[model samples]
Target: MRLALVLAGRYPDLRGSQVLVQQLADGIRGRGHAVHLVTYGAVASGRPGPRAGRIVRDLGLVVRLWRTVRREAIDLIHAHNYEAAIASLVVGRATGRPVVYHGHNALAEELPLYFRARRARGLAHRLGRLLDAHVPRRADFCIAVTEELGEILRRRGVAARDLTCIAPAAAPCDAAAHGPRVGSEALVCYAGNLDGYQNLGFLLRSFARVRARVPAARLVLVTHAAPGALRRAVGPGVEIVRAASYDEVRARLDAADVAVSPRAERYGFPMKLLNYMAAGKAIVASAGSAKGLRDGVTGRIVPDGDEVAFAAAVVELLSDAAARARLGTAARHAVEDPRAWDGVLDRIERVYRNVLAARSAASTDPEASAPDGLGVAAE
Candidate 1:
């Protein structure tokens, strides 16, 4: 099938959503399906330009996508995030093609984090809610990245028949060698964007507690984000490292004694968690963000917002070599299924076929095109 994978942001970036989209496109192409990445660029430019520039870029994307669909005879448009999804829906209406909306996170929960002031954040939340209520429902089908997100879409009025939750998958990396390191400094790593939604402030506070007990422990913030203010505030015992590529990011995670995801965003799955598991790193993540982990099995799951417990969990894993080895091994084994990627692709293929079938049926029978009747037909 010919597919156009749409993303508003730059593609091939280290960000979670972009990483997932890149993997999906690669997988689809590997499976002999035609997949075109319709995104801004193949590399990140470090900073978002002016608002006016962003608007012009998006407008350009809509025009480019419309032309690509017509020229390529694309069978489907799979759009990621709100902006791309909205654009795809516009093209879908004009060209009579099905569009799938792949939801990464709830806009209402994530939008407010971009703002600092209380009043501005409140306004952002209101605007996000308005989009959340309208956007996903317009898609021919909605694919949510986590069960939590699927439920959120349902609550926001996306019909259950039109939605499905598929957890993001990762290719397994070579397990990092875990040998005993008594009397050695323990290294903890947090890799991702430095956005406010990442809850880095909480990570810093928790790391401070971790340091109180294990004075030699060091925390590293590995990201492409410029660490100007964050670096100034991190003080001693914390290092902010910039990763030039995803390969370097993985290498840093594999080298670390422990990996962490301090984000409390419950609805969205943290893509780093998949990387941590793939790298066989013992992890400590807040309960809300720990999507696929089992407490004391694959990784240490601490209650959200509890710096004390989060720190203690990291400390325990740091000191216990055997525990770390056992957990890391289990984590690696969890994602080693050679068939995992194939399974994800299979489900997605089914969605595409069904959506196309439903659209065909609707075109032939006008009554089948009713808003409530729009859904991916059963396999």
Candidate 2:
């Protein structure tokens, strides 16, 4: 099958969405399917320019996507994120191709974080709900990243028959990767972007309490994004370091004694949680972001927004080597399935086949194209 993977941001970037798309492309192609990328990187200047600049880039995406569909004869359009999915739907409508929306998170839940003022956030949320209700329903199929997100789509009116939840698989950490080996007695690491949704403010506060109890404890923010104002958010003992590549990210995780994810959003999967597990590092995560972890088995799960409990969990793990070893071993075992990637690809291919078959049947029967009864279940 030939596929066009559409993204609004830069391709091959360190962001989770881009990383997932790149991995899918590599794996799908390895399975003998062709995949092409459609992104604004060709026409846009920065990652995301100002308001006016963003409007222009989005329009450019529509034009470029249409051209790519015709030029490559793409059999399917698999779009990631809101803007790219909208653009793909437009092109798919005109080209008579099937489109699949790969939902990373609920727009209503995430959009409000971009605005600082209460009124602006409320307005953004209303607009996000409108989009959420209207957009995914128009696609041929929808793939949600988490069960929580799938439920959100169902509430937003995406038919159960046309939606499925497929979580992203974590790539194993490379032992040979190069990164800093800090000398802190106990190191706590968080790796990802500095976006508002990361809930770094909560992390900083919790780390401050941890520092009070254990002065030897240090928190490191490892990311590919520029720290900018985030450096000011860091109190003493917390530092942000820029990671150049995934190898460096893995290396940093390897050197850390404890890995942490403070994200409290319940609708999306935190990729870093999987990374920490793959690295065999004892983890402390909020209940919302702890996807595959069991309370005392895989990793420590704390209630969201409880700084004291979060701090205590980190301090406990740092002081108890046996507990850390046991939890870390369990966490590593959870993601050690060698066939996980193949299973993901197989599921995605099934969706592609189902969508294509439904479209074909609709072309002949006319009344068979309704999306209300076309979907595969999340296994």
Number of the top candidate by lDDT? 2
- Per-residue lDDT tens digits for candidate 2, residues 1-379, read 8899999886557777777888888888888988988887734224221256777777889999999889989899999878999999999999999999999989898888877899989988998899899999899899999999999999999988889999877643221223444455788999998887888999999999999999988888998777877887799888888887887787778888899999999888888887788778899999999998999999999999999999999999999989988998898788877577678888999889889988888999998755533577535
Backbone clashes (count) for model 2: 0
Error of 1 at 315 (Å): 1.0
Displacement of residue 379 (Cα, Å) in model 2 is: 3.8
TM-score per candidate: 0.93, 0.94
Give a tens-digit lDDT track for model 1, residues 253-369: 767889999999888888888888877889999998998899999999999999999999999999998898899889978877857767788788878888887877788896875
Backbone clash total for model 1 is: 0
lDDT score, residue 81, model 2? Answer: 79
Error of 1 at 21 (Å): 0.5
Lowest-scoring 10 consecutive residues by lDDT in candidate 2?
172-181
Highest-TM-score candidate: 2
User: What value of lDDT does candidate 2 attain over all alpha carbons?
Assistant: 0.84
